[model samples]
Target: MYLVGKFEHSVNAVQLSALLDITYKTAWRMLNKIRSVLSMESQQIWGEYIEVKHEIFNQQALLSDDRLQKERSVAIIKSVKRDENNCSSSFFAFQLLSRRKQAREVLEHSEQAEILIRLNLGGHSSVDMNPRFQQFQKRNTAGDLVNSGKRTCHPLSVIASNAFSWMKDKFHGIGDKYAQQYMDEYCLRLNASTGAITCAFEHTASLSLQMKH
Candidate 1:
């Protein structure tokens, strides 16, 4: 609770152990179990106009050759009704994909038209631009739609940048296996918006209660 909610940060086993006056193994087990409850598994997300972005990060390991590179994709979905009111409420989904095939499969599963993709100027776009996906009509000009004299508004890109910055500032760096858990935590924060710290505490406590029963 203190490490995750109070500090709004992530700590490795050793750091957690020292902070909590517990053994390293005990801290590791505790953190992993808590992360399990926060996992966003099998959730379905849909949107009329969606923004998708991908970023790759490198994590360090003990051995010189043990470093690994991982890619994460973020999709921000805007609801049609909110767009009409000029107040867009964004819903997001995230996946940790290491291969192009995995990335393609996830995008196919979402399957929304009027999609705005944000990529580095020369970066590889793993999204398949199939005619079928493009055929679906746009309900609102929401994501990435720039108005006259306004700079392009890529909401997902902003979200991704902030998310990555938060992770780095709080946790330093995360492992590939636990990457999704951190992403899920941030998504929960985004959804809650206000009173996010309280929301995180409530969520973890609720899941803990369920496990005991």
Candidate 2:
């Protein structure tokens, strides 16, 4: 649910089964079970600064054999704004940091200002895109996309793709419930690409020490 769900596209049990290398019947049974479990309410974790990307795959895409698929995936780099930090930017910038200094300095505004404004005001969803979504896209976000804007290389899509690429590689496939788990891990990694991991480990160590005062 997380990867495709974050993108807000529905996946059938059969497709989930193939992706996860499980039986079709098993996938169908598990999907219902998991959805029932998740019917309870949930809270949203707002991303104060984000580089959100959305991709779409039609039904045919999901149903086709991997080698036979021909559907297109559109990656949107929506609201790539950054917050004045040591917090948001620390993670945002770290993700953008490159082999050279130029990459570090590039997209400074796009990351902090333009992207931020859009996410806060624009509101993106599946299928029909927000006008704001089109703004500062590959064409406008110069620093972020190399080889010119000829390619649609939005940050959100790029990061998500990399994460999914890893998941597909490691697990070969994911059942719907399991797919959701992997997606959660991906979101946490993306959202926590900064100090949360370190802060968490440090907190654990501090608790273990029983610090004096």
Candidate 3:
């Protein structure tokens, strides 16, 4: 049932329940389990000319007293590699800040450096030498990354915007608690054409076998 339609169109609990002829609770649990497996499978270490940017979901709520609980700050990292013909292909990863963490603090220069170190643990050159990293560092402030005056509609921005729209349209806007899981689902779906579904199934089977032992 999960593999039913185009991979881009996610199967929500309501749709899954109707398709599988099961109770909503059961369908929700099953979908969550699948999303959990996908999240685990998608935890990849990115390298080679990585580009990092911040995207905020629910921007209108950023100034609210309970903004920390309502606003979601995500770091979108794109890793690009060039082929023999100088053609480039990109892979993406998304990381969300903890509910209590603010974007400005967590997406700052130091934090971005930490993320780069983690992604390039294979001991690539100093991140400072990376032009993409330099571009990120040149930003006046982390806050500007999230609340920039000019909203250029770049590819990464379009992906982030689509993610927000997907969540709002499919699930009627997810809460902070399970937002990351939904983000994982979206990432997996985005990469589905690149054999991500096979990887997710393999991870799911491995997890099931481990549980049996």
Candidate 4:
């Protein structure tokens, strides 16, 4: 709890054990089991909106003669707030987007998503390009990415930024291996806006049940 509180984070094996006063290993096992349900295997493929996001990840490991490049994982999330007065009681729909041309092509082949998102709704997109990669040897914020904008940022950027903020606040930092699962679960939680805890809980429980059986 001490360590976690320092980071203003939640949903992790460390805190779970401390709260229950259980063994570290036992807590780890339990956390892993529950967290597994949130993994990619549980990602609901609705074929609903394509080109929203999650299109950025489709890279393959390259055979290296000598060159090793760093991999970048960028997911753009868009959301719409459900109002006090609306047809749908809750939810702000979000979409995962991609930037690589090849990624888009594969997405098109798989889901036929070109009309819904308008693909290039935001001008000067980061998708559809191949840049030389680099490797990191240490832990330090990339100065190149530290933005000092005048009026915060663009709308799409705001939405994308907000999604991650919500994820980190509610679920803590999602490690590389379990990120998708965490992401899926987080998306599910935010799907129903205006604080529908009951609905989110039921839906997540249903998902867990399905995964178990």
What are the per-model C-alpha RMSD values against the true structure?
A: 9.6, 14.1, 6.4, 10.6
**Segments of candidate 4 deviating more than 4 angstroms:** 1-9, 39-71, 74-86, 89-156, 163-174, 194-198
- lDDT measured at residue 52 in model 3 versus the true structure, 0 to 100: 67
lDDT for residue 122 in candidate 3, whole number 0-100: 35
lDDT of each residue in 92-198, candidate 2, tens digit only: 21111111222112244344344334334244332122212222344435446443465554555455466556556655655333544445444434433444334
Worst 10 residues of 4 by lDDT: 129-138
Candidate 1: global Cα-lDDT? 0.50
Clashes of each: 0, 10, 0, 16
Error of 4 at 97 (Å): 8.9
Off by over 4 Å in 2: 1-52, 56-86, 89-137, 140-149, 196-213
Models 1 onward score TM values of: 0.55, 0.37, 0.69, 0.46
Per-residue lDDT, model 3, residue 141, is 39
Estimate the TM-score for candidate 3: 0.69
lDDT of 4 at 153: 34
Model 1 off-target regions past 4 Å? 10-14, 40-93, 101-153, 195-198, 211-213
What does candidate 4's lDDT look like per residue over 92-210, in tens digits? 33333433443323334323234233333333232222121212222324423333422223333444455566656665544446555545545555553434333554555565788
For each candidate in the order shown, give its overall lDDT on alpha carbons.
Answer: 0.50, 0.39, 0.60, 0.42
Q: Which candidate has the top score in TM-score?
A: 3
- Per-residue alpha-carbon lDDT of candidate 1 for residues 1-213, written as tens digits (9 for 90 to 100): 445544445566788999889999999898877777765322223334433444333422342322332343334332221445566454554545445443323454333232332212122233323212111222334533333333543445566567767777777777667877777667666654533224556766776676778
Q: Return whichever of 1 and 4 wins on lDDT.
A: 1
